[model samples]
Target: MYKLVKPLLFSMDPEAAHHTVSGGLRSFCKLWGGKRLLRTAYGCEHPALRREVFGLTFRNPVGLAAGFDKNAEYVEEMAALGFGFIEIGTVTPRPQPGNERPRLFRLVDDRALINRMGFNNQGVDVAATRLRQLKNRENLVIGGNIGKNKLTPNEEAVSDYIQCFDALFDVVDYFVVNVSSPNTPGLRALQEKEPLTHILNTLQQRNRKGGVSRPILLKIAPDLTHDQLDDIIEIVRETGIAGVIATNTTIGREGLRSGERLTAEAGGVSGMPLAARATEVIRYLATQSGHAFPIIGVGGIHTPEDAAEKIAAGATLVQLYTGFIYEGPGLIKRICKKLVAG
Candidate 1:
């Protein structure tokens, strides 16, 4: 069904296509037996596919990455497609419109996307309410991917993270501190040791203050040096956080086969272009840190083999965004079947 529609979706603007697909799916799921029909067609379940990571039990290790569901609007709609988890938001404390139009672009030749969305979201409170209202969340693992507002200065970034954390605490299963998106000006600087450590420590402090603390993970950029990764390892250990999401998106356009015009678009690139580097970061974090924490590997996964490679490279779990878009829903079941076969 997706193959038949891919060409039509491809003809539209990338961001507009995304909205159309999401809205269409939501509307489809609202029909009689729609969600059940979706589940019957796409859901894959096996004991072998189950995973226990970071004090949470995931029905499978495959998850929907953050940017796709930035406002928590499609949690149940996506859950029906058989993802083990779904991450929502690079949400901020205050609502802000994202970067200008044409911010999201598709590079069809390279099977990748370049987006400079600038963390546009309806604020954390709205997402929290949406999650809180979810009725069928029994086995679903939801993660809140939190970030600072674009207008907030770097010095005051910690407060924004804290506000998001607090607002989402009761609702989300885990928290991903998003300081790695390249679209946000000066946001990556928070990945530096002093400031990064400060933010994590502050969140950790709040996380422990409650009766039950949710696991917190740091999301890092794939563009980091070995030294920076070492700092990341040290920060994770020092902060006693749960784990790491090995990459956000990369600004580097080293080997893209797409034309110069699309390649020159300023933003982070994700999809097939990011697979090797993302897996490399996961392996580095795992080996360098002696596999001390879980890693959720996501980037360029368009097939079951790509998902398996991340697991083989020490990713406790894997996620999909671009690949999910390009490959369609069957990719999740195919990946679970592959994992079970092994």
Candidate 2:
């Protein structure tokens, strides 16, 4: 059904199609237990699919990754589609218009996308307001992924993270500290030991002092070195943050089936080509932490086997971004059903 409608969708701008899909979903869920009926039909209900991690009960291990619903606009719609959870936004403290137009692109031949979206979203406060209304829904776990403003100097980035932490503490289930997006200038530099520790520790401090604390997870880029991954593990232990998201998108273009110009496009590449390196990162984090820490595996997870490989390699759960674009909502049922087989 979606495949037939996809060409019509692809004819429009990527962002426009995203909004259209979200609006349609929001309306569909209003149709007399429409959300419930869709979940009963499309969602996987096997008990083996349930996994507890970071103080939350996920109906299944598969979640739609952040950057899909950057402002919490379609959490209910996505939940209706049978995703166990959804991560919303790489939201900033203050809303910004992000980069120029045509920032998102699709390469159909490679089943990949290149985006320099620059975290374009409504600020944390607006997003939190939208999210606070959805708290009572079932089978819908939302993770708030936050980041610094584009204009904020890198030195003062922690303050931005702190602001978002305070505003969204009561709304989201888990917090993904996003310092790995390639679109934001100098954002990846925060991945270094000293800066990363400062941000994580400050957020931890605020979380402890706040009325209610949310699980804080650090999201890293796959482009980091082994030494950097070790630093992340040490930081997690030192700060006692909940878990690690293991990866964001990567700038590396290795092993792409598409030609030079597609690879040469200016942005982060995601989709099928990201699988191996992302799984390797998950394994490395597991090995480095002695499997004591939980990691959410995300990258090129397009099939049941790709998801199972990440779980075996030591992911507490898995997330999808580009795969969701190429494969449609049924991908969740496909992956979760396979988990029941094992």
Best TM-score among the predictions, by candidate number? 1
- For model 2, residues 1-342, the per-residue Cα lDDT tens digits are 788988988888887887898888888888999888878877878888888998899999999899999998888888878888899998999999889978887877878888999999999988999988874567567898999999999999999999988888888889999999999999999989999999999998888884778889999999989998888888999999998886788898777767887678788988877788899999999998998788999998989999999999999999988898888888889999899998
State how far residue 256 of model 1 sits from its true place (Å). 1.0
lDDT score at residue 207, model 2, on the 0-100 scale? 87
Give the clashing residue pairs of candidate 1, or none: none
Please list the C-alpha lDDT of all candidates, in the order they appear. 0.95, 0.88
Q: Cα lDDT for residue 130, model 1?
A: 94
Could you tell me the lDDT of residue 35 within candidate 2?
Answer: 85
**Model 1, backbone clash pairs (residues 3+ apart or across chains), number:** 0
What lDDT tens digits, residue by residue, belong to model 1 across residues 1-342? 999999999999989999999999999999999999999999998898889999999999999999999999999989999999999998999999999988998988999999999998999999999998998895899999999999999999999999999999999999999999999999999999999999999999999984899999999999999999999999999999999997899999998989999999999999999999999999999999999999999999999999999999999999999999999999999999999998
Candidate 2: list runs displaced more than 4 Å.
none
User: Lowest-lDDT window of 10 residues in candidate 1?
Assistant: 130-139
lDDT of 1 at 317: 96
Which segments of model 1 are wrong by more than 4 Å? none
